[model samples]
Target: MTPAQRRRAAEQAARRLARTSLFRRARHLALYLSHGSELDTGPLLRCCHAAGKAVYVPRVLDGQRLRFERLVEDMPMQRNRYGIREPALRGARRGAARMDLVLLPLSAFDTQGHRLGAGGGYYDRAFAARRSGGPRLVGYAYALQQAAALPAEPWDVRLDAVVTEKSLHVFRN
Candidate 1:
């Protein structure tokens, strides 16, 4: 999709997300910064800020794990090994389990909540120990990214829901 198209779709998806009870109840949210043709997260970030929600973005650590740091205005930022920009490790960070909601980026997804990331296992490893009532894992992507089905591994972390420009698909209670 073109830049303008992607922006418009992202805005629509963000509006859908904002209307969800999950988004309304969340106090601390972990969101990814938009990169490449992935769905833009600018609209969601603005919505979160407007609603007085604390927003965090992931920072890659040791090229393996993800550390979520609060996203503050004018905070320092550096690109990870994959060229994804992340908040610099300066202030207190929150673990995945501590967040109320986590919006993950994906390359593809299915109704079963399986997500295909950028071939990196950072998110999976970070949430590997997630238990019941833990942070809700949500995938943020475009509707076109949905596939009929995708293979899953035993260690794969399933998403609780996936929000696309078209709609929101919930897979778990």
Candidate 2:
């Protein structure tokens, strides 16, 4: 899809997501900034800002760990090792367990909610401590990113749902 088409699709999906019970019930939301051709999260971020939800973005730490830092209007940002813009404050941190909902970024995913990320393992490491009752994990991506099947490793954390431009694919709870 062209850039304009992608933007439109992202906006449309954000609108759909804003109406979902998952999004509505979320008090602390974790989202990723768009990279490459991934679905742009700008629209979703805007919605979060307008709705008064506490939005957080990831910052990569040592040992492939990720810390969610609250996003504020005046907070300074910088590119990390992978060149992703993240909140510069390393002091104020929130663990994955504290998040109400997490909108994950993925390269590819399966119908069963197996995610193929950028191979960084940051997300896996961050949420490794989570039990079955942890925060809600949702993969956000374009519809074209869905795969028929993908191999899952023991450490691979499956998503609870995947919000695509077309629809929200919820996996078994």
Candidate 3:
């Protein structure tokens, strides 16, 4: 889709997210910086900032796990081995368990909220800690990325919901 179209779609999805009770109650949100043509999260980040929410972004570690750091205003970041920008860890780290909401990036998804990631296990490893329930995991993707079906493994953590440009798909637990 065109840049204009993508922006408009992202805005629509962000609006839907804003209307959710979860977002309203969430004080800490985990978000990722959009890489390439992925649905731009710029709008969502702004909304979270305006709502007085503290946002955290994951920093990939050597152990194939993620260490989330609080995203401060104008936070300086450094790129990881994979070229993904991560917030520089200047102090003690915070994990995903502390977040109230997690907006995850997905390469593709199905109606069941099965997400296809970048083939890395960082998210899966970190998400394991959330199985007992902590933050609400939501896959952020464009409507075009949805597949009719996708294979899911025992280790592949399914999302609680997925927000697309057109609609929000909430999976049954």
Candidate 4:
């Protein structure tokens, strides 16, 4: 399918998820700004901002490492190395707090709950390191990005749920 088609599917899915209890229950959220091929988060971000919740975005720091900084109104944004736009905070290397919810960008995800990232493993390491007592990991993907299978590695952490524009795929522990 075309990029537009994929994005449309993902956007619809996100809209559906926005009405869910899980999304409504979240008080603190960490979400990504959608670029090419990722699920659109503009609506979700606006909702969070309007709700007066603390919103954080990731800044890719080092190899497979990312730092999350709180985003306030009218915060300056910068283009990161991955071409994703993130809120800029100079000299702000504070560790990510234990968020109530984390919205992940997914290149691909499987029915079995495996996620294929952008091949940099940034999300993999970030989730692994922060997920011990952190928020629920939710993979945001277009329905077309769902696959039959994905190659799993040790550092490749599993998600608690995968959200498409259609519905939430909650994994059983």
Return the clash pairs for model 2, or none.
none
Instruction: Name model 2 segments beyond 4 Å from true.
Output: none
Q: What's the residue-level lDDT of 58 in candidate 2?
A: 88
TM-score of each: 0.96, 0.95, 0.94, 0.85
Steric collisions counted per model? 0, 0, 0, 3
Q: Give the alpha-carbon lDDT of every model.
A: 0.92, 0.88, 0.85, 0.76
Name the top lDDT candidate. Answer: 1
For residues 1-173, write the lDDT of model 3, one tens digit per residue.
88889999889988889889878999989899888877888899889998998888888778588888888778777887877787765644677787889999989999887899989877889988575568899998888999999999999888999988788889985
- For residue 143, model 4's alpha carbon misses the true position, in angstroms, by 0.6
lDDT of 1: 0.92
Candidate 1: list runs displaced more than 4 Å.
Answer: none
Q: Candidate 1 lDDT, tens digit per residue, 1-173?
A: 88788989999999999999999999999999988878999999999999999999998878787889899877888887788888766666888999999999999999799999989898999899999989999999999999999999999999999999999999963
Q: Please rank every candidate by TM-score, starting with the best.
A: 1, 2, 3, 4
Model 3: lDDT of residue 97:
83
lDDT accuracy of residue 51 in candidate 4: 74
Model 3, residue 107: displacement in angstroms?
Answer: 0.8
Steric clash pairs (candidate 3):
none
Tell me how far the alpha carbon of residue 7 in candidate 1 is from the true structure, in angstroms, after superposition: 0.8
Highest TM-score model number: 1
